[model samples]
Target: MADDFNSQRATLSCFEENKPVFDSFKVNIGKGGLGHGLGEVEFAHSPLEPLKQEGDNKAPIGVFTLDAVFGYEEDIKIKMPYLYATKDLICVDDSESSFYNQILKTPKVMPKSFEEMRRDDAQYELGIVVGHNKEQIRKAGSCIFLHVESSEDAPTAGCTSMKLEDIQKIVSWLDKSKNPILIQITKSQKDEVLKLYPMLKLEE
Candidate 1:
């Protein structure tokens, strides 16, 4: 978890059946830090911290499913459901549009605003879709993912990012049958988070 809401970096650990998959690695989060988001577990809104909103640059804080794997490639070897990010593919962020939070082929349904899945950068060359605000919660944040970091290792708009190799490793290791989920929270909220997910045990 991040040190706090304003933090841009955090240590990420992977486990399968409670067994460590690898040593923890560092990852970059949203530039604005973490904010409460719609997820498997609900957190009480704190006046001190903000709730997740579109373009907030805050990574959502809670448990979320790893829905799918997407890339610019036509096909990938990963087991998760794969999506080819064609040049015309876009993830709609315009809350007012019917396609809000949905990834669709361009021109078929044009939203006022959207993010191109196929980018000139390598960051979107490989990515895993994070099921944040899956219910299409308007302005509650959208298009979250675990993707490759920028060349500068900079923080993302709201997605989690890391070294390309690290992201590749994670993508290869993920199994849809296992129902993998990401649990993100600050250190201070560890105990509370564990209580909600009794099966999860973090190192002291």
Candidate 2:
């Protein structure tokens, strides 16, 4: 009899400033409390500056919890709770607004200083919410997510983007019961991770 929680945990890691166009990430599955490399994905920016502010365009370098999975499809299947981003759904980025960094479904009426979750482009066709700065820390960044890349070589606005197929695989691979977490790292933090958890493998 084995505990499923410890075995199913997944870690998504990325190195700081790894690439000029897009950063690379590796997704691994935890087995017997050790991380087994599952596959690789691309993220944007190594994030030189802190990610606690808007317009940084730098992906946060730290561990964040996977909150929710969203897609435009009506019946998309995934390991976590899924939501369909309607045309009226938006995430408030206004630091002053009480709803800052919060997603709201406001049908028929558009709000100012908000980001529409539903977009004409396919970049957000499917996205996974990253619980970064979830406390709504003013000016500490907002609307961070793991989503699809518009172009294979283009960078994202402080988000981890991947190919549609890859994102789908990641969403499917996640296990909610395991408390799956994403540990986005940088060059500086690499040694710390390796020192703390040698079981986790890092690939170039």
Candidate 3:
């Protein structure tokens, strides 16, 4: 097991130079859970306030894809996060509302983009591209990206949030030759990613 772990770690380590393939991955986090470099994508970026199909604060979970990109006007061909932004996107809910609890597509503009809904929170102004397809993960919730937060006073509606510069760095790094996709997440979840990937193991 130790040898296997080490080998895995080495393989992933090699990916480090690969540019954009995240060094680690997972789905979990808590308050004060933050990281600078790439990491495991979390199930929920901001679970403090969820969309109201009536009224409920439920964070999304489960495996998903790193689909298309957003925000950036000009498309810069990269491995992943091709011009994606936290402007608008997320796996809609399942309860099936006229609007709530459903995977929505981009340009859901005017009709309350992710930024407007979380305006009160600091993570707004950012948008996430929903990764999960109801048919794929079969999970009961949504999954999306994390980019440009509104600020630091509150949590996101359920999407992750990062800085514009970091987003640009991340986008540029992601190339098909490497990770091919970008996964957003926090610390608590990063541990689990270490266990699954082994390549993320640390000496300390």
Best by TM-score: 1
State every prediction's TM-score relative to the real structure. 0.95, 0.73, 0.47
* Tens digit per residue, CA lDDT, model 3, 1-204: 111100111111113533334543222221222222212344333455222121122223333345545554444565655443333434334334344334345443323322222234433233345453334332233434455645433334344454555455555654544434333222334555556556544422
Global lDDT of model 1: 0.87
Tens digit of per-residue lDDT, candidate 2, span 70-136: 8888767666888789887888878887887888787354445888888999988988888877778
124 Cα displacement, candidate 1 (Å): 0.5
Q: Which residue pairs clash within candidate 2?
A: 52-140
User: Each model's number of backbone clashes?
Assistant: 0, 1, 21
Question: How do these models rank on TM-score, best leading?
Answer: 1, 2, 3
- Score residue 84 of candidate 2 by CA lDDT: 83
Weakest ten-residue segment in model 1 by summed lDDT: 195-204
Q: Rate the local accuracy (lDDT) of all candidates.
A: 0.87, 0.61, 0.37
Candidate 3 residue-wise lDDT at 62: 33
Ten consecutive residues with minimal summed lDDT in candidate 3? Answer: 5-14
